[model samples]
Target: MSSTTRRRFQHPAALIGAAVLAASITACGSSDTTSATSPATSAPAPASASAAAGVLTVRDPWVKAADKGMTAAFATIVNDGDTDVTITGVSTDVSRAEIHEMAMADGKMTMRQKQGGVVVAARSQVALEPGGDHLMLMDLTRPVRAGDQLDVTLTFADGRTQTFTTVAKPFTGAQESYAPGHGASPAS
Candidate 1:
């Protein structure tokens, strides 16, 4: 990886904070009566055919509402497993999705396709939010407005796919400009 890319991964404190938040959300939302000491040992599993059931949980997922062009999705992806997992790609019916990272380019923060993939350390988590790593949704098929629900699927390096739903919300932040051929400017 380049020096700039390496620097982006230097923020351990942020990753840790995201992990803590994800764990708290999982604990609060779970219905299992099992003790905390008896944690599940299996590897991260894909969501079941019915609901979003798996060892990897996406907490508080939401997409930026946009009428056209591009927007992004943010969430805290928690991996409850003994080994690390890499998010290789993302897919949504509404638009094309790519794992993107915001980094300095030409003296300004630019958004581009992330090299390799997003790695969630074992028993840890990663946050996909504005001004950081996010899922870029381009070429929208239709308008995504407030209160709309989007079905997104995350593809893992190991070929396992986890499907989740992210609600569209009105967000004025991260108003970066997007050009069709050129990359995103002034990334948020």
Candidate 2:
């Protein structure tokens, strides 16, 4: 056999030795639940009070102000429970708010509503950022101005709900910037 081919094979004794070594390593690392001398594992950190909502936590929710018709809200939702949490719907003090996602389709920027829901996996987080997953507020009852606070409620799959006081901040970022002439003007 060629040296390269021979190098890939090991003797029977070597294989058996490797197997035994692997098993010993695994056993050494295994946690023995019944062992009296075993130290207890630390519990997970508690969720912050301002963010905790049922098993989900919301952080830094804010809405972008537009010059008229629509705007978007962004936040970080963290799932702290053992099971996944899905955001079913959103309610705002506006005409309508819907969960939406923005993506590049055929080289064009396209925005679409999310029919199912936004899922935050167990022990994980989902961020509703400007140009990505976001909450679209349409038919605004009033203009969202900088320094204004709005109430927003999030409905979850497990019948739990969370309400956040989102602040309106003037942002010049590209991620969630409104289209030209899309921002609504203030009524007289």
Candidate 3:
């Protein structure tokens, strides 16, 4: 572990989404119910500029817990430096990591692979939301349920691995409510 300890993060998205889901968390960082997620983890802990002598801020981390073979993760990668941070991979206690993207095809909702990568601009942030982008948790070794705290370590392009803590929450919207780009459809 780096000399820097973990500190409280208040990212823009976390501040905004916290109001909506804060009540859903049962305990301090545990979710009140099972939610939806991406594949497995993010990537393979790649080298990143985000990596510093301090702890990287990964906020709003959420994943779903079903008996299914798939899951997703969402969070904000905040860099406390001036270099552009590229998140190469993500990891969890469940399974390996892979980058995924949700796309609507011919009236059918599907999530596929993201070949390139997800980038967090220098001195900026990146958010993983429902309709936008996220990390996929695949081939779960076990079922992640409510009240579970997911330990995710993100790798940057600079050979730095930053571990973050994410609290699970019940996915608020309907199963088919149409998120915009991902699975959410029937836009009204």
Candidate 4:
């Protein structure tokens, strides 16, 4: 081919290649940063409260690894606003999620749904830990193994939602009994 013809083809090819590279970078570029010791924080959501409400964030979010049955997620939900924040519901594509509490019922500790959702007071935080309060993932759509990452969405009472990514790790604690009709037993 002549030099002019070659230049025309090469210019378009270079442009296409650059565009693909840029697209790849954009797809993989996520704001979430996590480490073995550090917690993964969610992006700041708009302050539903006054300007002093600041922002809401989830810290050190993680999930339990399980092949099937049920597992739970642990995190510290921080609310920096002047008004209280209530997480009414939790959701994930991998399973049916619910905010659960382990409380004494009939002389025994049993796991059941939280009655009034989870309330994080103004300028305070709520810790969702094992054997206390947690986000329960039931009937997993697929097996969750160690080192896997999952996206969890928290719906606030004000109709605002914040989605965060959490990594799965092996956890053997919180062996509380499940209430009847909840679902299959928790993974041992």
TM-score of 3: 0.60
Tens-digit lDDT string for candidate 4 (60-85):
67787788877788877877778999
- For every model shown, the clashing-pair count is 1, 5, 29, 2
- In candidate 4, stretches whose alpha carbon ends up further than 4 angstroms from where it belongs are 1-55, 177-188
Q: How accurate is candidate 1 locally (lDDT)?
A: 0.73
- Cα RMSD of all models vs. native, in order, equals 16.9, 20.8, 12.0, 10.7
Worst 10 residues of 2 by lDDT: 38-47
Q: What TM-score, computed on C-alpha atoms, does each candidate reach?
A: 0.69, 0.65, 0.60, 0.66
Clashes of 3: 29
Instruction: Give lDDT tens digits, candidate 2, residues 62-90.
Output: 67766577888887777777888889888
The parts of candidate 2 lying over 4 Å away from their true place are 1-53, 179-188
RMSD to native, candidate 4: 10.7
User: Per-residue lDDT of 26-115 in model 1, one digit per residue for the tens?
Assistant: 546634232432222222222222223654778767777789988888878887788989999999999988999889889878788897
Q: Residue 98 of model 1: what lDDT?
A: 91
Task: Give me candidate 1's TM-score against the actual structure.
Answer: 0.69
Question: Of the candidates numbered 2 and 3, which has the greater lDDT value?
Answer: 2
Residue 140 in model 3: lDDT: 76
Residue-level lDDT for 156 in candidate 2: 86
Per lDDT, the best of the predicted structures is 1
Please list all clashing residue pairs in model 2, or write none if there are none. 67-183, 67-184, 68-183, 68-184, 69-184
